[model samples]
Target: MAPLSIQAPDDGTVLGQLPTDDAASIDAKVKAAARAMAGWVDAGPMRRAEVLLQIAADTKAALPELAEKLSKEQGKTRKEALMELDRYIGPFIQYAGLATAVGGRHHQLGGGVAGHVERGPVGVTAAIVPWNFPASLFGSKLAPALAAGCGFLIKPAETTPLITLRLAEIAQVHLPEGLLDVVIGGPDVGELLVEHPGVARVAFTGSTAVGRRIAARAGQGLKRVSLELGGCDPFVLLAGADTGAAARALMGTRFYNAGQVCVAPKRLIVQDAVADEMIDLLTTRINRVVPGPSLAPESTMGPLHTERGRAVLEEQIADAVDAGAELVGGGRPDGERTGRGWFVRPALLLDPPQGARVRTEETFGPVLSVVRVRDEDEAIAVANETPYGLGASVWSADRQRAWDVARRIPAGYTWINALGRVYDELPFGGVRASGMGREHGVEALESYLEDRTFIYPAASH
Candidate 1:
């Protein structure tokens, strides 16, 4: 069979081809991973940590090359790609030190008996990553799985597998063979991995619709599934907040990764007192964001990964406009640039109708809907109206007031007076339809492990 072709999103240039995998090949890889799991268990904690550290070093050494490939294939700016590459260090280092943390616990019973809980690998684990933020998301799964003494298989998205394959190539040398595997294909390949009997756990990051399917399939096997799904996150500004700072912060969230981020601020719910001032400031920031090729340093934003993605954004914007939403700026392509890439202008819709598509659906583009609310109560009500509970940010002059507002918002992660920053030490995931299990931190590594309890009678000794 012919390999799948990967094209650069910037200019539709052919980057390379990756061989597709079938069920038979996937079975062989799973068996290989199962075999490698034994050796990994025997390697001990220090050795495992050492291997993770070495992988981190190798990745650091290859940052320049990896970032370039990521930018070319993933449709992110070169600067953003480099930032993703640099951020990989945090997970690798943190996981390396956390090797000692994934251990067993002991408890004494009252009747001369003791209970012991031992943590062990859940067998071969599959990590199905999405195209957006591939490298960073890979580390979120890979580092922790390695620390937990499990074999890891990566099934990267078809459009953006080059950088991940390159990382696998660099990593396999330092670790045991079969400890890390990379398979590139579309949804079929993912189906095989999720339904494979040998795979004990599935770590997935993508749309909620696909995540529901994967979770259902994994559940039939009684397998563990960790999902980082979609987000319709909200950004709120209270009456007393600094309009300038809050506007700039919220603007950055929508423009980051061209607003393709799962946790990007999708809805802007502002108090009526400062809504007009905030809109003016936000529009000023939005006007300065220039969309161009990902490789261009001056381009503040880049194109979406595919033409289909752009069309989806266009449709939603059109629907919102038709529903009486005001298109403020940058709805059409810039006249100065040639029409070659899948590009959309930065758009701000002021006072969109309640049923506007932009307000209801996850736009996943450089578009934002600004809605004014009567008070804090109305702001919270509007923020929680969406089905997604992934992430949100609340801005207020008083820290206590912001914290109070953040608590009322139903999201897995909420930032008070901040935006677009996630730490490796903190847990990252969502509630409701956003995702199933958590990723990052100690909880992430333990998610790939299963615990067994043993009770022994003292009389036997």
Candidate 2:
């Protein structure tokens, strides 16, 4: 089938048409990646780093074009999309340099000291990337794979395959033929990518349910796997918090990527002192966020990636309202083709009932759930109630108190008085249904690697 051009979620730009690879095409690419992987993985660390550095240079040169394409196809404004691309360069270079500088650095043990701890690639890797942050996600997974001397076959989300495909072309410039190949299709293609015989490990970023299925398939093959799944991270405003600070942080967390971020703020837990004030401030801030194509310089919010995306969000909003949640601001999209594109008005849901959609489901939309609680214990209990444990935040005037609450939250990463932001030098992963395995920091290189213990007694020592 030919590549398809999909509409942006809201007033965003079209995420350009993408060529859809057929089953045979995919098979060929998978084989090619495996072949290239074997050769690439065998190269010394210096060679791999050289190639990776080249990829970084190429990525920088292509930023403008890539960003334009990202906006057109992914519904991000050109500026936002460009910035996203810019984030990949540094991480990519960092990992590249680590390719050889990493591995078993010869750790010391008790007594006479053991040999060395070594890490090597597990061979071919398949990275199943998502749509919301295509370039970043793909690069995040792929960069480390390359650094670990692993070859990869990527199956990008059907809704946003443009960047991945283009990346394949650019990557080939620095890599050997078939070092990285991107295939486009739906969930079925992903199934194949995970289950393929040549694939040694499956690195996936998507929903929890899908992550489970992928795990099952990878299990059947006995292939190593790493999954980065969904989240409904909670943002807590303590009694002593500066309401203005909490409000500003919540807005940035809840509405980033039009709330399509898997680790975005899903529930707002506030203490009495700041509850009412937080709501008022949040409402005003949400209302002012202008909606347009993701490519537009003025666009702070864009349409959901698809009509179904909007529908799911709307249903959640409606369900939350029916369940007695107060709709604070905005309403539904005017029509299917309203406001220049798939634009949805930003909305805030206040005090949603226990079973409300805004409360229970991951409404990957321009809506947020606001809830009030009496104290820190209830706040923690409410925050931990959800199945997700990806990321969370706490805002309090007392730094120690904020840190205490942040630490107690059942999440992989916690922030005090700020939304969760990632550092490439640190680990990022979630517990529970948010999926397993660390994606960044030192472990990122290890994720694509297999460990080997080398023991050399007096003879070697």
Candidate 3:
């Protein structure tokens, strides 16, 4: 098989090449994981927690080098790359603590009957992670799955596999051999893992389209699956909200990592009373972004992770602009500063028609589609317009009103006057077309486990 090329999105430089895994190799890994499953489970929760904590410490010690590699290959700023590593390490500690707490209950029944429920590992789990925020997403899946005593196999996004590979290397030093492994390749490799009977569970983080395919394929094999997919999340600013704060929050979340985040505020819905001020403030913030190489200190924002991603974003912006939406801020930034990177100027599309691609599709770049509405009812109506229900945010001066509006949004995760910040202690996932199953909190750990009930005579006890 041809090796997968790992390129720096900042300049299209070939950073490294990794051997692509074939169906045979993937099958071998799956079988190996199955072999390792019992030993990993027998290691017990406390032992697993100790291993995870050690991995976290080693990862932190190697943070600088890892973050730089992540920044280059993933096309995120150095600061963002560091933050991603921080986010990645956190789940290990969190799941480590939670590992010891995983347990089942006993139930008493009438007529001398009793029941004891126990949870066990779901066997080998295949984690398919995407390029955007690869380390953090991978950690989120891996930590919980391992904490639940499942053997783990990861197939990282081909474009940004290096950092994940490095992480796996760091982690495997503390893990049982064959207990944690990585397969390097694209969709074909992923398909193998999903279809492999030895893989008891498949956890995926990517587009909704790809997620559906994984779900369908895994369903055939009766494999447990969790999908964290695309999102066109809405940021609704109700009347009487602090427009400046909203703008600042929008600027941070929407444009962070060049707006490649799945939970970023893709749709900006503002009540008429605050639309103008909100738009003006957001526009000013967008204009200040300096797009350049990810490793450059002066670059406030970095390039899109792929040429295809940049092209798709450009097409969305063009389609929206042609549909009579006002393009307020940045567009495609062309200059020596951008070099050969896949960079785009952060843009704000003001009041695009609901039918426009930017308003309809998940705009996966630094573009915010602004929609103005008459009142709160329209705001909630517009928020649920998209098929995605991954995440949404409601901003209002009145806490009760914001909470009320937040409740109306159909998203799985809604923020009331808060930025798009995901808490590790809380459950996070999506509804509608955004995919299924949760990724964080105890729920994620539980997904990797299966329960069994043992009922016998109480007199036997």
Clashes per candidate, residues 3 or more apart or on different chains: 0, 20, 0
Ranking by lDDT: 3, 1, 2
Reference-based TM-score, model 3? 0.98
Show model 3 residue runs off by greater than 4 Å. Answer: none
Give me the candidate number with maximum lDDT. Answer: 3
User: What TM-score against the true fold does each predicted structure earn?
Assistant: 0.97, 0.92, 0.98
Report the C-alpha lDDT of model 3 over 43-105, residue by residue, as the tens digit: 999999999999999999999999998998898999999999999999999999999999999
Residue-level lDDT tens digits of model 1 in 1-461: 57999988777889998789999999999989999989999998889999889989989998888988899899899998998887766788999999866789888886899888999988899999989888899888999898989998999999988989888888889888888898778998899888999999899999999999999999999999998999888999899998877777877677788888998898889999998888888888888888888988788788898888989998988888899888888565655442778888888888888888777688888888999999889999999888889999999999998999899988999988775688888889999989978998888988978899999985663
Highest-TM-score candidate: 3
Off by over 4 Å in 2: 1-5, 10-19, 105-118, 333-340, 454-461
Give the range where candidate 3 is weakest over 10 consecutive residues by summed lDDT: 330-339
Better of 1 and 3 by lDDT: 3
lDDT of each: 0.87, 0.80, 0.90
- Whichever of 1 and 3 has more TM-score, that candidate is 3
Please say which candidate is ahead in TM-score: 1 or 2. 1
- The C-alpha stretches of model 1 lying farther than 4 A from their native spots are 335-338, 459-461
lDDT of 2 by residue, 1-461 (tens): 65566656555455466667666777787788878877786788898988888988998999888988787777766766876797677678878778877657675565665667677888888899888888888888888899888888888888887678787788888887887888778887788778778789898999999999999999999998888888888888888778887777777767877777888788988887778878889888988887776655676776677777777787888888888888877665454345656567878888897877566567787787888999999999889888888889888899998888888888888888775677778888889998899887878888788888876663456
Worst window of 10 by summed lDDT in candidate 1: 330-339
